[model samples]
Each structure stands twice: as C-alpha cells, then as structure tokens.
Target: MNTSASHDPNCIFCKIIAGQIPSKKVCEDEQVYAFHDINPWAPVHFMLVPKAHISSMAQLGQEHAALMGHIMTLAPRLALEQGCNPYPDGGFRVVVNTGAEGGQEVQHLHVHVMGGPRPWAKG
Candidate 1:
C-alpha cells in the first residue's frame, strides 16, 4: 500500500475501506479492498477497489499503473474464492465503469468481478 494514498470523506468505497462503513468483505490488503456487492449480478459478484481515492478511470495515469495491475491480479483470484469456477473454461468478468456515460454509479475506481452459471442479471 502506498502511504500517500488518500481517501475522500464522501466516497462510499472510501468509507468502506476505512471501516467507516460496513461491508461483507471478501478480502483486504494495504492496496485494495474486496467485498460482496449489495446487489449481486451473479452467484459470485464482488468488487475490488483501490484504497486510494481515485474518482474514476479518467483520473488514472502512469502513477496508477501498479495499483491498477494489483486490482486486476486480485480480481479473478477473489472471484474464484467467492465460488466462480476455475480458469480455461469456468471464468469471470471484470467490469470497470468509468463515468456516468459509462454507467458508473459510484465515483470511485472499482472493478466488479462477476461469475458463476449464467442467465444472471441485476434487478
């Protein structure tokens, strides 16, 4: 985890990362926080978020490369741990919605890892 990482007081993910908000956490390290989605889109649906307060992908730069990589690397492992099948045939999807136009409801940069048997959709 980067010591310079900052949190936004009003960001839900920030609050969740800080223990200010409660979440059904899947995992957490200094760099990221993984948790079950309040409204799951699949049998396995969770989010991996950076501890930093990045507003969106639009704000990402070279400085975020390592953090982004860390999140990506953790997503599938956590997805499988949450019950997604193994790789090669059984898999998951990693979704990161950027702005409002991209259907991002939250301002934080978080990746959604969703999997399991399909015909899955969020109500």
Candidate 2:
C-alpha cells in the first residue's frame, strides 16, 4: 500500500520506465508501461506495468481500483497492437504473479499478456 513513490531506483521496471534500462517497449502512457518480455513465453508476449512503484498485487488496495481497471481495459488494445489476433478465437492471457510463491521474478507488479499461436513453451 506504499504506492506514494513514483519510481524505485532499485526496481528494474522503474529503471526501464525511466529509460535507465533498455526494453522493447510496446506502448507507454502517463499511467502504464508496456514492453516485450526478453524471454517470451509465446509468440506475442509483453508486460504492462504501472508507472508507480507497486511491489506486487498483494500491495494493491481499493485505491488502486481505477488503475487496475485501466490496465485491464488497455490490455486487449495493446495485445492487438502487438499482433495478437482478435478475440473469440484469438485473444491474449493476462497474468499477475502475486509473490515469490506465485512466480514473480521481479518485485515490480506487472501483468503478463501472452497470446498468438499454440505450442508455446510455457505460460
């Protein structure tokens, strides 16, 4: 719930957002930063992260509702823009790894958007 900080100098995502680290950016705005995963799980694999330094989903509170909704609504558009086929038959998957047990590699909260063809190595 300590969402006051806009960036974390030690957080990798923050560095990517601040341009201190290079990333294959998909899209970015005042609220979120979307970038391609270096080790893609699917043909179209990217992540959408908040500009603010939120450690993980466990830290999210009701105050983050609007931001979370914005991320959800924006996912499809970004997925399509990244070459994921349209919905119904071809769509994307949104994943949020909560903590260490949940498989989050980085401390920064990010929604993994993966889609495109089958035979993907893993999700």
Model 2 global lDDT (CA atoms, 0 to 1): 0.92
What TM-score fits each model? 0.92, 0.95
lDDT of each: 0.87, 0.92
Candidate 1 TM-score over all chains jointly: 0.92
- In terms of lDDT, the poorest run of 10 residues in model 1 is 1-10
True lDDT of residue 107, candidate 2: 92
**Candidate 2 residue pairs in backbone clash:** none
lDDT (C-alpha) at residue 98 in model 1: 81
lDDT per residue (tens digit) for residues 1-123 in model 2: 555478889999999999999999999999999999999899999999999999999889898899999999999999999999998989888999988899999999999999998878574
Structure candidate 1, residue pairs in collision:
none
